[model samples]
Target chain A: MARERKFSLNEVFQHTKQLLLEHGYEGFTFGLLAERLGVSRTAIYKHFENKEEVITAYMVDEMEQVFAKFVHIHDYPTFDEQFRFLLNLILYHDDLHRMIAIGRRIPDTTPAVRANKERLEQFHERMYEELNQLVERGKQEGRIKPHLPNRIVLAYIFQSVVVPHFPGISLDQWAESIKEIIMYGVMTGN
Target chain B: MARERKFSLNEVFQHTKQLLLEHGYEGFTFGLLAERLGVSRTAIYKHFENKEEVITAYMVDEMEQVFAKFVHIHDYPTFDEQFRFLLNLILYHDDLHRMIAIGRRIPDTTPAVRANKERLEQFHERMYEELNQLVERGKQEGRIKPHLPNRIVLAYIFQSVVVPHFPGISLDQWAESIKEIIMYGVMTGN
Candidate 1:
């Protein structure tokens, strides 16, 4: 009888990702990975040329997801819903340590850092366009202030939640506070 | 007569700051730094233990200036002036890359990365307190609208600037646009 194949390649890649998320760059050394997998390092070699290649593949995949999310973020039904999504990313975002490691794994600050900053940067336009559209829609529907510039409003909401602006707060608190401000600003201007 | 000292340690450290600001963190290596000082690596070592120690000192010193400026930020006599100082950091805050590096520099996610996360997270509060005081004062003076909580205002002003919700813009432009939003929120109801 032919020898049975052990684990599928996707399974191997998933295992590698767990090791990376748990171990970080140093933790994901080839020896340790093979030991973790109970397979020869050569088995890993069959799938990946080296450790960097494996990790880089994982990172590229993650970057692709971040970009795809950027495109699909506007699919949420309402501006409030969109703001909620942003808040989820900002206050909690990933395990900051894990995400930071992901950042370090990339090379170069100017060009993609390992994947693509330009693509990531342009992702904002989609967000802005949707935000502007929402605000215009809100104005028409009498849900938002007529005076608010959709672009500026969108920028404000996006900036606060994504970057480290407030310290020692959870995403829930961050979202609640932003919604509060926007609520007050657009209300009562008579 | 005793031979004159070539250059003081303080002088060397000062020049290192100038270089780091000009070249950025990736390009700011010890070899280049030593070359700039016209000294050997050994001589540089005599004064400092390593590159990180140098960087920590420079960054901490920069943070000190920022902190001091915030203390006096409210002394600017008007909301517009105080807002100007706030925007200065967001819009023209040079060395953010280095700041990010110092806070998020660990290559792999590990205990060291955890340690860095705490350090970076703490840095956020340094500015929050300053903004909080201003918001409290703004509300008491009735210059800021009473409907919004100071904490909420402080949080919104900060979060919106860093991770911007939109794409296709420079951080500076995003910050500038958000600055307007903050000002608009406090404006005499139009």
Candidate 2:
């Protein structure tokens, strides 16, 4: 009888994220992934044909997890509360933006890869649609400036995900400071 | 008699920037540069041994031009005036951020390239020093918030260089809006 080779999909995805973040798209490989998984290459091969398949799958999983939670933004009673919740969520998934950029560079070498890429793009559209509602709500409440284009406002908020971490600042402080800056900017008079 | 091959340093640097922007550092080539310059490959080889030397030389020229203007920030008198001047200058050189990032990836393979890279790094530090003075002045003037770290404030300003252009908006309007947002944020109450 052949020995059993057992590993959960969650474990595989955790390792995928780690490797992709550590090595980027170019450096990610099945050999390294298999080693990290503590399993034979055959066991890994049983699920995916190539690195692109694995990465795309990981991205899809990530998008699903993120958007699932993002759907609850409407649950917040006010635009201000919703804005804070959104920023906090975005900050929590700090690596998502980098991951999405990496995903764009992944070639559609196979049908499976192509399909996963399409799914990721759909998730992206859904995300922007969700954010747009928040922008609309802010406008309705007269919180956001009227003349500002919606896209610029969205770009500013999205750009916050890339703000460099400062030493001696806690994550909560960083998020709060960024939220304050986004809402009122650096001017003390504001 | 051999034909003369003549091209100015300015012309060469212009083509260098164009090619670097189009193909990135990895795809940049003397062959392509010669094609763009309408000169023989030997003409380029006559000036620099490799692509790295030419690129580093071009980057050094760019830094000199930018910093020459940056030095005059002190002439603005007030912190508000100085801040506006700095943002306008930065917005004008929109590609500078991308060029500087490409410069960082250039390997120090030769002595000439190594020297040029060091010069670029010094220019970068000098730039931060200049910006730091502006930040301090703003704080002293009670314009910028006191508790915020200097780096975050600087990062926010620098990141504006990457903001996507909105269709149908004039550059003047765009710059003014960005300056307004940076100072007072998107909040109407401010």
- Which candidate leads in TM-score? 2
Candidate-wise lDDT, in order: 0.57, 0.84
> Candidate 1: what is its chain A TM-score?
0.50
Docking class of 1: incorrect
Clash pairs, model 2 backbone: none
Model 2 CA deviation exceeding 4 Å by range: A1-58, A99-109, A168-170, B1-12, B19-54, B168-170
Summarize candidate 1's per-residue lDDT along B62-122 as a digit string, tens digits.
6665666667775688865776787666555444443644434434334444443555456
Off by over 4 Å in 1: A1-46, A50-52, A63-158, A163-170, A179-190, B1-29, B35-38, B78-80, B94-131, B142-176, B184-190
Report the C-alpha lDDT of model 1 over A100-185, residue by residue, as the tens digit: 33545445433224344344335445545655675676667665555545666654554444333346666565566555554444
> Each model's TM-score?
0.58, 0.81
Give the per-residue lDDT of model 2 (tens digit) for A43-74.
Answer: 78888988899999989999999998988987
- Note the DockQ of each predicted structure: 0.23, 0.44
lDDT of 1 at A6: 64
RMSD of each: 7.3, 4.1
